[model samples]
Every structure is written in C-alpha cells, then in structure tokens.
Target: MLKLELPAKYEALRQRVRAFVDELLIPIENASTAGTDLKPEIRARLEDEAKKRDLWMLHVPPEFGGQAGDMFSKIVIWQELGRSIAIPPRRWAVFGPDPGPILYQLAEHQREKYLWPVLRGEKKVAFAQTEPGAGADPAGMSTTAVRDGDHYVINGRKRFIGFGDEADFIQVVALTDPAKRARGGISSFLVDTDTPGFRVVRQLETMMIDRPVELEFVNVRVPAENLIGREGDGFRLAQSWITEGRLARHGARGAGVIERCLELGVAYANERTTFGSKLADRQSIQFMLVDMYQHLYQLRLMLYDTARRFDAGEDIRTESYLCKYFGDESAFHAADRCMQIHGAIGLTTDYPIETFWKQARSFVITEGPTEVMKMVVARKVFEDFTKTA
Candidate 1:
C-alpha cells in the first residue's frame, strides 16, 4: 500500500522545483547570499519568478486559493530545495502565506485577518511554546494565562522562538490549570506583537545564520476571541504540528543534505589526485562513498514510505520520529564523511560543505532533538510490545 516513486500528478512540479534549485539557486547562492542572509533583491526576484510559474503556495488547500500539494508532493519538492544551502525553509512561499497548518484552526474572520494575510506574505506569525527552562519538556512550562472576563491576562517568558523577532503576532501556549498541565488545562492564544507589555527580550544567535529570539510577556491581555480552538486543546493541537514537523522540517532537509554531500564527495574524489593517484582510487575514500550511497538509498525508501503513510491519513507518530531521528543522525555522519573527502578545504566557507556541516549539526537540535525522537520511538516500541499481554 506504499507508493515509492514520485506520484504522476506531481512529477512536473517536482522537476520544476528541482531545476529551480539546482540550476538557479545553487549556482548563484554564494554571490547572492550576504553571509547567511539572502540579498533582498534576489529574494524578491526569486519569489516573483516562482509566482510566474504558478509554483507558490504549495501546501494550502485548494479552497484556500492554494495548489494543495499533499504531504508526498511536499517531500518530493523539499528534498530538491534542501539540496541547496541557500533556500529558506519554504521554497514555494513567494506569493503567499506558507504558515504552518496551525492556522487552519483559526475562525473565518480570524483567517481573514491573520491567516490570509500571512499566506500572502503580508504578515508573519510565530509559535511560542518552549519556555526559558522548558525546551523539550512542554509539560514543564511555567507560563500562565488566567481568564479576566473579556480578555486573558498572560505572563510568561518564551525562549528560542523562530520568527518571533519579526512576527506581527504570536501563537502562544499557556497553562490555564497547573494541576492538569498538558492534560486538560493548557490553552492556545494569539497575541499581537504590539500588545502592551509584550516585549522581545533578545535575539538568540547560533551557528545558524537566521537568528531566533526570546520573548517576555508581562501581563499581556489578549481578547477572548484570540483563543485557538477550545481551552485545553493546546497540547493536542501542538502535538500534531510538532509530529508533522518531525517529518518535514529536519527529516526532509537532512535527506537533501545527505544527497548533496554524496554528490559533492564523489565528484571531488574522482577529480582530485592524492599520493600520486586519483583519490577515488583509494579504498578509504571509496568505502565512505559507498557507505554514503547506501545510507541515502535506505533513507529514500524510509522517507517515501513514511510520507505515503502520512498522505494515507495513518497515525505516523512512531514512524515520523524514527525517520527524523535517523535523518538527524545520518545527515551529520554523511557530511562529516564528505568533508573528510574534501579534506581541509571542506572546513572553510569557500566551500558549501562547511555550511552544510553546520546546518546538519543544527538539524540535530532543532524541532525535536534526536534524543527526544528516540524517546518517542521507545514509547511506541514498549506500547506495541505490551499489547495484548
């Protein structure tokens, strides 16, 4: 019941995205990117070009004025875009709102005011959940939002939120009942950035070029209408988003990086001479190349299988974690091997391998760390093992 090949319907679009990334983006990436930031003119022009090809808004539903590329199609396109170090998270987000699926829970008027504008790139929204002390432990959060008649008074500190520094508003998760925590007391709220008492504490810079930030909420009052879904649905809703991200965010990106590393490594080995012979002739380098290829081969099967299951509407929590965990580990391994092939040259920015290595390192820690992913996998294993016992 698994479709391993690219679906026929998406083949054209896949190739188009692939060509755009390989021929256009990668070739000009070094020149166009000022350090880690893409030049404004280049970003604008690329978006405009994607628009001309009708390639924008690939993930939204058709009813929402999007092309409605399913989970499988997203995998296909992102793998290609991921091969390029220069492309941002959303490759086809040129013309509209590429807000994650979280916005689907918005009310009609809320969508009109918040979601639609974001899909159009007219506004940006950030998700706030990880607290100052609660990175992987969502249930350990201390932020609280108490109801105050017409509005909820929120006070909390959220750390390492991507896009928080630039977003017009934020989707926040708060503890309404400390006794229940993630069980039945947590809630989601949308708070505008300019709301009194809401403040950006600082931008957190890492080896990653695009910096994320921390935010402090001091008695920030949000209207009752700003609540997403019903109270206590926060953790449930956030789980869906997090689980989905386990596949798309680091998984797909890692797969692309793996593929690129192998490509560059093989080419360099064949062309470079070492110790009076082609580097490819050395067994040490040959074994690494072979191992890299095998890893990608197996990764492709796992990636497509998991994606097919997701599109078929199956519960993929365990499978997604496994895929993401493998991706996080395997990508860095592949990059390190490739860099070994490139020797010291790979350590410098003159080559993209250095950046790829850092990005792969970053992937291991983002979304959910490999350790958390392993925890999810272990839970599923124990549950299945004990079934009917």
Candidate 2:
C-alpha cells in the first residue's frame, strides 16, 4: 500500500490551485453557464496566468516540465478543481499535457515530437482507441493499417474521441496483422491531425461535460517512425494505460462528484423549508444526508487505498475494476438522492446539481461499463480462489 506522507510542498500547491480556481475559473464558468462562450483570448489570458503561477501540467513527470505529482497529490488537486462548474476546461488546461498510454511505449523521435509538445502545452493529444464497432472489445476493431513502402496507410473511422476536435495529435490503434489479432498483430501510431486524409467527421455532443468527436482516416499515411513500441504491443500498452486511467477517474473525478453532491445536499437542507419547517429539521432529509455521507466516506477510502497500491507499483487491475464499479454506483446514487432532495430545481439547469447528475450518469459508462467491471471482478475472484484451492 502507498503511504500518505504529504511532502512539505503539497499544501502550497493545493492552495495555489484553489486560489486560481476561485478567482479565475469560477467567473468564466458562470459566464459560460449564462450562454457566453469563453473566448480564445480569455482562455489564453487565463492560461498565461496559470503558467505564471506554476500551475501548468502538474500531473506529468518533472522531466517533462510537469510538477510530477503523485497519485495522492493529484487526488487533492482534482477534488479541488471538481468543486467548480467549469472543471472540464480548467482541469484540461492545467493537466492536459501529460501523456497517456502512448508515453509508456513512445519511440525516441515520437517522444520529442509529440510528448514534449504536450508537456509544454504547445500541442494537445487524444487517444482514438474506440470505434463504433469496437466499443468494449477493442480486439474486435476493424480499423486497418497496411504497410506501404516506408509508411503505413490507415483507413477507418473512430467515434466518440474525447477532445478530438482540438487535439493536435492522436494515438490510434490499428490491426497490423489480423492473423495474430491482439496477440501480436495490433499496432499503435502517432498521427498528426494536419496529416493528409485525416478529417474530423463530426463533433458529438454528449450528455457529459466534455465535447467529443468522430474522426475519419481515409488513407492517412504515417511514417514507420511514428509507430510506438513493437508491432504487437499495442494491446498490452492500451491495457496498462486504461487500468491506470480508470483508477484516476474513479479516485479523482468520481470522488469529486460525490463530494459536490454532499455539498449541494447540505446547502439545500439548510435553506429549503417544507411543511412549515426547515428541511434540515426533517428526519427523512437527515437520513438521506447521512446516507450520502456514508457512501462518500466508503468510496473515498476505497479510492485512496487503490491509488496508494497503484503508486507503490502493485498490479491493481482487479482493484481498479472494483473502484470503477463502486465509484460510479456510489456517485450516481448520491447524485440521485441529491436531486430527489432538491425536488424540481434539481432537474433544471439553474443549479450545478443537474449537471453533476448528468456527469455521474456518464461515469457509469465511460471508462468501463458497470456491468463489465463486475464481470472483471468476478473473474479475478474466481482465478484467485481457484489458485488457493
């Protein structure tokens, strides 16, 4: 298990981010909620301010111009950012530069070309692993990359790519050899958005907080050098990336939604009155609030425990599945109860509670569906017990 010894500098970093959000991000989000777009100039200005405050790319390694934050520290930062209505954009600006699955298997030139630019905020990256036909079973993907001289010509369509419209580069998975399938036939490539034949088919507007896109690669050509790692290691690399990413999502984002639900519930209980008495005084409301608190407490402990284990270099696939399942279920339940407590106002866009409820619902399907996670848990349990027996 990972220990929770906070470095002396952790508190200072936390305070800096909290102050930045309070003074800058909250105002921008409020304007956005009023149907005003955060103009590019305004975003740039805030980005400059954030950079000046040394708050950029806190999640990446220090060598990559990041603060090299640990899992626990990232949990703190993400939770603080989650309190605001504009968390998606603000958090993206601060931590978006960090490399994902591609980093683990980056070629030398690829790292300098793609990873470095991301860390410096000069470029944005997105992963294109999912397709319309390959939602859960990635190996079932039909996206093909055929070798042509010194380059590979990729032709396929990827859907629901998060932040795809604004990404400077995308890491794509393709079948190099269908005979081996995922065993040694899958390959990954770094494709520049400006490359010929690469096009954004459409921007997909979802119920969640972020905007995703569908991309079409019509004979997109990537040089051999753009390939990441060995030709057949893409599946393994993707698994590692998703396992770590899912943990972060469950630990940080899920925890944040739960905390926000509790906050809104508490505030509502104090202000709203029913039957000539304050809602806080009602036994039913009190019981619901207590339930929300209990859920949050249990989820946080599980999240932190899993995160600590991950940071300690332990294999946490099973734990991550458990975290993802419980995290989504707990947050959704809390958000539902919160909405029930708020009555009609909860359904309206007038408050952030409605938005939180939508985001929680998305969590149930995003990283891995709740059903898939449970299956993973059962499989792991069966394997472990069988070994002991």
Candidate 3:
C-alpha cells in the first residue's frame, strides 16, 4: 500500500516552508517589488534565514552536499515556492540547481568546471533548443555544429531563451549528424557567452516580467570537453529533462496558483459586501469559493499522487501531462471566476487575482501547450490500446 499522509518529518518540513512563504515572503510580495524578486538586502537576509531554518536545498541530493530529499520532498518545496514569483531562491541554495539533465551526464572533470558552479549558484545557464522554425519539434532544428579539429564550430540562432541575457553560457542544441536528425543525430554544446561569435542579439519583450531573448551564434567555437552527454544524443537528453520540468513547473505551479487564488477569494468573500450582508452570505459567491477550493483539492491530490509515484520509480510521463493540462485549466478558470466575483477592484494591480488570471492562462501554453498536452496523453492511450489489441 502507498502512503497518502505525509510523514511527521515531511509535515514539519512543509510547515517550515509554508511559514517562510506566508510570513516572510508574502509580506515582501505586497511591496512594489511584489512579483518581482525581493530587494538585494532583503533577499540576502531571507536566504540566510532560510538556511538557518534548515529549509534550504530541498531539491538537491546529498551527493551534491544538499539534503538530497526524495522526489516528494522536492515536489513539496516546489508547491510552496510556487506560491510566490521569487522562487528556486535564485542561487538554488534553497531549492537546488535546475541545470538540465545533460549536465548530470557530463564527465567528472567537465562537471567540476561547468556543473559544480551552477549547483553552487556561481553561474547560470540556458538551454538553446528552439529555433524560429523549430518551436515544438527538435528534429527540425537548422543549427549545425561541425567538428573542426579540437572544437565544434557552432552556427545557429536560438529564440525565446528565458534569462539568456544573464546566462554565463548556453547549451546550444545543434545537428552533429544531419542524416540521423532526431534519431541520435543532434548534440548539445555548452557555448560560452563571451565567445567571439556568440551573442544575445536582442531581448524579446514579453507580457510577463522576465524578458526572454534571441541568441545568435556565428561560427562560435565550443571546446570538445563542453559537449554534454554524447554526440548525437541532444534530443534524447532534452526530452529527459523536459519531462521533469513539465511536471514540476507547469503541473505543480498550476496547483499553487489555485492555492493562492483560494486564499484571496475566500478572504474577500468573508470580509467584503455590496449592501448589508457579507459576500460570503450570497450563494453565488459561496459557490465560486467552493469551486475554486474543489479545484485546488483535486489538483493537490493529483500532484501529490503523481509525485509519490514518480519518487517510487514509476513511469509517470502520461500522468504528468494530465496533471498539467487539468491543473492549468482549473487554476485559470477559477482565478477568472474569482476576479469576476471581486468586481472592478480585482482588475487593478493592487489585487493579485488579475495577475493570477493572466499567469494562469500563460501557464497552459508553457512547458507544453494544452493541445500538445492532450496529444501526449492521447499517444499514451493509443499505445496501451495497441498493446492490448
């Protein structure tokens, strides 16, 4: 039988993280810096506080000098951190590094130089897989990395790279063996931003605060040692890493949004009124609260169940898609309805409901679009059908 209740140890950890998010972080969130990160001084102080409270690096493993908590622990941390915009503690000091799976495939010597720094928060990196023409399909990438003696000469453009401007280097996914393409033909190379031919061409303006950018590479030379995983394994490495991201970022994040929306909506319903009675007294308003709560409840169950299975080494890729698809829709619709219940005040920046609404909608498209999510689930369904047939 599977354990449904969090152990005392996990519960204690959860409470600590919840206190940090609610008492410490939420207060800071109301400031002008709300949704933006905390101020430098405040961030340092809070990070120090988190470290002292033994609430840091829950996502990392003991091998990396981290708590090396189980996948469920990491999911719990993400759920809490997802409550706010300032997440992963920037330095990954509190949440551990999100360096792509390929980094873990690096040779020990190469890891010492590239991987350790990221884990230590001394550096940041971006994965360059999508091009102007290759948004969903990695096989269609036109970027090429031709080997020239000791280095691979990379020539390509990567679009919509989040935080690319600030990244120390980019893991450029390039075609090393065109004949194979997605079939063990693509490769990933960590190209330094300071390289002569590598540059951030421009930062693409976005509705969200963070500005993703386009990176241009004109014959950028990447050292042989910088190759991550093996040559012609780029697509495989990318798919492996993106699976975790879809679950953690999109799936877990959607549930967290519901949690926040419920907090705001319920509070408003209890305190605010149009006439002589509280909004909570109105059946319509109460129904909205119930619906949002229901979504949160269901999403939380799905997320936790999925996290538990994942930790137990079960294949949960299909479930990950389902969780994200359902979670995104539930959270977005709930937030939209809550905003409608709040009247005009909800439209203002003073209220987080509008932000939640906007972000929730965007969440559907990120990681994988809603359509793609359904496609993945369908693929799984048909695979099972064929097996039985």
**TM-score of candidate 3 to 2 decimals:** 0.91
Better of 1 and 3 by TM-score: 1
Q: Model 1, 168-267: lDDT tens per residue?
A: 9999999989999989889888899999999999988787676778999999999999988888988987887776677766677778888888889988
TM-score of each: 0.95, 0.89, 0.91
Name the candidate, 1 or 3, with the larger lDDT value: 1
Candidate-wise lDDT, in order = 0.81, 0.76, 0.76
The C-alpha stretches of model 2 lying farther than 4 A from their native spots are: 1-12, 26-28, 33-38, 89-91, 387-389
lDDT of 2 by residue, 1-389 (tens): 11334456766776787798778876666444322224566667776887788787777666555676467666667656766666452234444455764574576777788877776668888888889998777888889999999999999999888877888989898999989878999888889999999999998777665667899999999998888887887888778777765666654666667777788888999999888998989999989888877776776677677777777988878888887778778778878888998999988876777777777788788767888888878987888788652
Between candidates 1 and 2, which one is better according to TM-score?
A: 1
Hey, what RMSD does candidate 2 come out at?
A: 3.2
Q: Tell me the lDDT of model 3 at 107.
A: 82
Candidate 3 ranges with C-alpha deviation above 4 Å:
1-4, 32-37, 86-100, 386-389
Best candidate, TM-score: 1
lDDT of 3 at 34: 34
- For 320-364, candidate 3 gives per-residue lDDT tens digits of 888878888887887898798888998887777776777777777
Top model number, lDDT: 1
Ranking by TM-score: 1, 3, 2
